[model samples]
Target: MRTVAARTTALAAVVTAIGLLPWLSGKDPALSVLRARSAEQEATEEALTAIRDDLGLGSGPVALLGRWADGVVHGDLGVSWVSGTDVLPSVISGLGVSLGLMGASLAVALLLAAALSTATLVRGARGTLRGGAATGGAPAAMLASVPEFLLATVLLIALGVWLGWLPTSGWQGPSSLVLPALAMGVPAGGLLGRLVDDALPAVFGERWVGLWRTSGVTSRRIAFAALRRAVPAIVPQFGLVAVGLTGGAVAVETVFAVPGIGRAALGAAKAQDLPMIQGAVLVLLVLGLTAGALAHLVRVRLLGPGLRDAALALPSPPRMRAGRVARAVPVVLAGVLLVVIGWGLLRDPFTVEATARLAAPSWAHPMGTDGLGRDVLARLGHGAASTVGVALAVCLISYLFALTIGFLPAFSAGVADIANALPPVIAGILVAAVLGPGTVGASVAVALISWPPLAAHASALVQETRAAGFLTAQQAIGSTPRRILTRHILPAVAGPVARHAVLRLPGIALALASLGFLGLGAQPPAPEWGLLLDESRAYVERAPWAALAPAAALALLAGFAVSLSAWAGAGPRGAAAPAKAVS
Candidate 1:
């Protein structure tokens, strides 16, 4: 009870702090409002001062927070500067749409996870359970690696363009939900499936399972029992997956033109609407925290206190070695990327072919032509460098930042945690609003947002490694702290850090793509994948190949990054390895 009370108090404090972020950021809210209204720059200083005073910007933080909290408790969410309407109603309407999408996606993910788990668990005696689990897990890992936008693009092309099976965009009926849900759910499902697979074997190995088997329990009954026991352990993980999916929905909603909170947030961010941005972020934070709390309660209720701890303490499953095909995947992907970049550099990607506008695949143009008669293949080839380059840059910068600050003490660690809690999309929007849109803005945004989680992970590992026996021995021998870190700790943590860097590439790529799609990255005439998709949206039906080509390239690149990470042994097994062993 005391713990719960402490947590509640902490949550309230954090939420209050978050609510004050916009004011504390040092951004001029009056200027933001004026910009939204497109007010003339020559407007007198008197006008600015009047606007600021009207908004009560002169008030102290405590007073402002108290007023905001009072209004919130009375069901008010302030008024939007852009729309001139009460924020609560619009937020509520947007929340309903987002909730529907999230709920559907969550249900689909859980079902898919269950099905995948069952398939792996029911493998025949002829196959080794380890091999079966690995085989089953590989697909999910690959899926999880693919960014949501890339997945959404591919599904849009395959189902909407090629097969004509579903609407390409918009939120009209049940059919529209299918593609978006799959896009959002598949990666999450893949992750959850792997979690279930890992937990089931441990549960089946319990002494109670042996007793049940000795007492003539059927195999089906035993499997059912194991699943029931495993679920509580998996529930907490589901919260994390849900949070990620919700964040990714910003891109998904944009791609599909869904009128959800994500879409509203994007618009609000673009317009620098402080009220809407604050309201959207607050709602999302509340939902994520509530879901996490509920999942914890469920776990405590279902497993009891002692068993839940035991389940969490179970040894992680064995690491599976990458097979021959897995090893060759990165090589093949790298070669293809090189070919595209080389081809792009040698030829003019912007050359027009007015005579063959909207042309299908042929000897003249392999990937056909867009509405503007530009070769899709050439555009994709050129875009490859920008897409892949931004991803690489973000990954390198973020990793370097992580390594540098992550080795620092608790102050840096606390800052990292706070930064990590800010969603990447929101960060990108804020950066773009301040810096103005371009590759530089997008890259900086992504790197800033991506570094926090990596820093937190690396810091924890460094702290753990510092406490190991070898480090202690070095310290006892009068070794300098710098030398100890450089010679011993650095090498110990390098593998995990490298793995994290690789794993983070796909997400960085997705973030860049999302920004580009929103016109905040790689401005006009630049062959960026997201920009290409954005430009081609109006002509999708007329020249589907233009969008399809870049979408496929992005998907392939994301997949390759994922495969490379997996091949490097950066999966759950590697992450869960003991720090003592590394030392």
Candidate 2:
């Protein structure tokens, strides 16, 4: 009870601290509002002073926090400085839209995952499951790899342009939601299907399953039983998928012109509307926490008494004998990346041909032309390089930060917990606001946000290794602490760290794209993927290929990264032997 009380208190304090971040940002709310309103700057200083006074900007942090807390308690989220309306109502309305979209997407993903999982299981009985899974899952894996913006763009082009089946971008009616939902759900469904596929072997191998088999149970019945047993594991992963869906919703909302909280938050962040941004972030945080708590409760209720041990148990690593092609996947992906990078370097990315503006794909302009008549192929190549470069740099910096700080007592597990609670988009916005926008700012933001999770993983791996008997023996034999760390601890953590870096690349790419999409990264003509998406929107209907080319490149790169991460390893495995003596 005491521990629970302490934890609640800690969470409250953290929420309060987050609420106070807008003030610490040192942005003059009045000036931000005036600038957004495009008002004259000549008389703004006096107006800004009065505006600040009206908003109680001169009040100390404690007083401000108290007032904010009181408002929050009373269900008042303050007013949007930009919109000049009550923030709560707008947030609620946005939440409704987001919820509807999220629900639709999640349902589609779950249903697809179940169907794919069942297919894989049915194929298992024929002794061709491996080949079947590889062939069947390949497209899903590719779809899963595609970044959100690219996926949305592709769908919009295909459905709206080529086929003329649906409206490209709007929330006018029920028909409009289909493309966006499919774009958001398909990739997630692929990931969930892969997870279900992986879990099936263990489920089928369980001792109790033999009894069912001997009793003349059909493969389909056994598969359904296996699926039921796998639900607990799949549920927690679905929770993660939900989080990803929420994050991706922002970009999806923007692409489809959906009036959800994500789009509102994006506009707020871009305009530096502190009140709206804070309110949106707080709501998102609450939603994330609520979802996680619900997932935990469901897991506990479903798994019963064994839930505690299961939660604590380390995941087993992939075996060395796992297929050669699977093991070589990362290498193959790396080679493909090298080729793309080489192609990008050999081409001119900025040559404009005004005569070919908005042209379809042709021999002269292979991937077609943008609104400005710039070659889509050239821009795609350059964008691919930029995206890959930023992701790699962010991963490298984040890994180094994790490795260095992960060993420090000052950066504890609690710190990681708090950091984990903060959303990546919020972090990116804050960092971008402070540092101003560019690749450097985006990279810094991503690295800072990326490090905590990696650090926590590394810390756990180190602790697990340190608890082993061999380490204690080395210490007793008078080996220096430095030597032991160098020879044992570092080596033990290396594989996990590498795998984590590989896995993190796609997310970092997405973050980079998000920042770029928001105009917080590489500026015009830089050919960053997200920036291209933003720029191509105006020409999407006229020359769909303008957007399609960069979208395809971004998707392919992100997909390659995802595939490599999966092929790398299944994260840190359990220690080979127990730490304590068996005697």
Candidate 3:
């Protein structure tokens, strides 16, 4: 009953929010429909009324919400506000493919994560990578920083265009799904890998492993045991990855021209097909919710009642000072990124020169010109401001908001799950509906969904710290809960949370890039990295640098930010017992 209620509430919230789009945007439903259906149609009062009456847009909020809710319940996703086609069948046709793609991508993610995690754990047996998620430094973050769209684009160019190895576009049998799956799965694997890699150390640090080792247990056997114990704890994170894949599909499908629900939703949004949008989102929501629930169940079952009940404090992972090599990587990368960003700050990325369009790289034009004949170097330089600069700003804002919310563990974690399950693209769609497509809306959309993770982390650390002897000592002295949290608990949690925020830079930047690629962020004349990649698509074969420049720059910047974050972890460890870890 509780599960049903939560699901229903989530459904209702989504339906209500989408139904209020027109009113919230202050746009006339009828006029918007008229323009979407026929730009040539004159918006006469009679025609407007006819459209309102036909589409039932004349109804009030209550009626509209009720209608959408009923429709969703009945599997009658209504007719497209433009096409008048039943949205259920339209959505279902592609939803199957998307689901299939999602499954394959998830499998690929698990495989990659297991491999990477195994390698990381084994390698770190002597040093750096064993402690926590942030400890892997650049590799995982760099992988995550490479957005799905960018990955898909590169694969398309290399495998499809250059080598003629696989089918480049379309959902033509199983062969077509490979690249798209990799595109979506690689980053997910990187994310999952970091979680598992950093977590197993805590299990390894357990007394049982050390006890078994002394009792003649082989290292391999002990490692396996540690993995089993650690995995269930982080199982819920896989659900977040599942949700992330659905979002990734949106951009991946667009790049690959796959007939997935993501592409359907994108088309529907462009055409203002309201019912189609609702139907697509509903499908995504159901799948995401279902995946999250299943992951939770898996965690519960794997642990069973014994571990779940017997489990002591879920100690927050420790942050150790990185080794010299680990510390150097980020510094080098940051210096390179800083140079690129600084150079970009001074260049002009907007001036067009048709004669030099698609120009090859030369002394006169270092990075060459783009499809529009705009200097690539200038755009590369200036685009850094929007992409890298905004990402940094968003991270700072999200961290601040998360810190405030962290004191309430239950609320913060729940919201984090919901936000994680709901794709950032969903937020982008909502923001676009409310404020139109632009960088600011996209940035706000990214910020809106990105903070929950940090909040949940902070909350977890807070709870863990609350159980520590020191906080109890404070309470015994009559310290108020607020003062305890602000003065003691938050300060301890702050160091770990700050490191997380730094590590999050690459992913946030990647999200912004994905939005831009989907046309939900920056439009043309804006040299935002994703937008630049999108515009470069037409002439990619003729001038590969147009695409390569930004892609390379993205990886460079992402690696730099992440490496910097990891390197910075070498600072003062936390003050509390659970707040910091050495190995």
Candidate 4:
């Protein structure tokens, strides 16, 4: 009953929010429709009134919502404000394409996860916990850090254009699906594998495993059984992965020319076609909710009635302690970053040389030239101030906000739930509507949606730390609430949150890049990494280096974050800590 009520509340809230988008955007919907329908038309009150009345926009907000709700109940989704076509058919068709793509991507993710799990298990139980996991996690983190959009571009250039092994873009045969699926799958698989690997160590240490081994259970069978036991705990993560794949498909679809719901929604959002946007978003929302329910059902089947709700509870933090290799990796990355900055300071990224257009990598241009013949290395250097600098600023601001509200997560719990469910790209669109599409809008949007994770972490840490014996003793000793928070609570919460912020810095930068790539960030002639990649896409066949240079910069950033964060986040060097339940 509680589940049903919660879902119902969520459904009602989303529907009402969709109805209020035009009002919240502060854009004249009638004028927007006029522009979308005929860009040259002048905005007149008479014409505006006609459009408004025709679309029932003149009605009060309550009436408008009522009409929309009624239409939705009767299998009517209305028509697109821009295209003036039935919304239902287009939404359904696009949903089908997106679902097919999501299914393929999820299948690839599962296969990669299974392969990684098998390799980890094959190391034998003795070394699996300490040796195999520590070595395996860093590489997985590196792979996971490679953003899907960058991966898609690389695949298109190498596999599609260079080798001519597959179609570059479009919706045709099965060959068209390969690159996009791989692009979305690889990163997801790495994260999933890491989570599963974390869970498996706990099962291996269980007493039943040794008992089963002594009772003549085959080692392979025992491993398989352990996998079965570990998997149920993390089934929801796969569902989250599915939801992420769907949300991320917007960029992949734009890159690959897949006419999925994500692309359709993006186009609609760009045009401010409210009806189309709502319809598309509604479909995606339903798909996400459905996927979660299905995942829950699968977990139940895996465990049966007696242990259906039982899950492996694992403690958070320190999958691996600070090793020499971990410390060395970040230092090396920072040094390379300094070198790029020094080189960039000496060159002018904006000077266009028509004669050197699309030039390949050579000593004259270490990173080659873009389509406009702008030096790539210089742009990498100059763009750092915008791309990397903005990312750092955004992270700090997000952390501040997280620290402020995270102490009482319940206050923002509903908001966080909505934000987490919505794609970062969608957030970009909403921010663009209010602030206009540019660097500020993109940065604000990324920061806006990204804080919830930090806040969640802060909330968890506060809960865990507040329950500590030291904190309890201080309270009993007559420490004021303010002093406890300032002296003990804030310091405790800040440490983990800061480490988490550093770990998330790469992702924040990538989010900014994604928005830029989508034309929601820094405009052209800006030298931003995302804009550089976006421009390179046109002539990628001729100048892959133009793309690779910026990409390498981003990759190094991810490497630095993954390595140093591991060391910063490590707790104590001791036995694998006891597991904690997330469910």
Best by lDDT: 4
Q: Tens digits of per-residue lDDT for model 3 on 374-432?
A: 88888878877778788899999999988888888666655654555568787787777
Ranking of all candidate structures by their lDDT, best first: 4, 3, 1, 2
> For candidate 2, what is the lDDT?
0.69
Whole-model lDDT values for every prediction: 0.71, 0.69, 0.75, 0.76
Candidate 2 residue lDDT tens string, 246-344: 667777888889998888877877777767777776776666556656766676677779664474322232243447877677677667656765665
Residue pairs of candidate 3 with colliding backbone atoms? 318-581, 344-381
Candidate 1 residue lDDT tens string, 91-111? 898888888888888888888
Per-residue lDDT, model 3, residue 537, is 80
Identify the candidate with maximal TM-score.
4
Choose 1 or 4, whichever is better by TM-score.
4
What would you estimate as the lDDT of candidate 3? 0.75
Kindly give the stretch of ten consecutive residues in candidate 3 with the minimal lDDT sum. Answer: 574-583
Error of 1 at 378 (Å): 3.5
Residue pairs with colliding backbones in model 2 are 145-559
Off by over 4 Å in 2: 1-14, 43-45, 122-140, 216-221, 305-340, 362-364, 408-412, 433-437, 566-583
Better of 2 and 4 by lDDT: 4
Clashing pairs in 1: none
Better of 3 and 4 by lDDT: 4
Off by over 4 Å in 3: 1-11, 119-141, 210-224, 308-320, 407-410, 457-503, 570-583
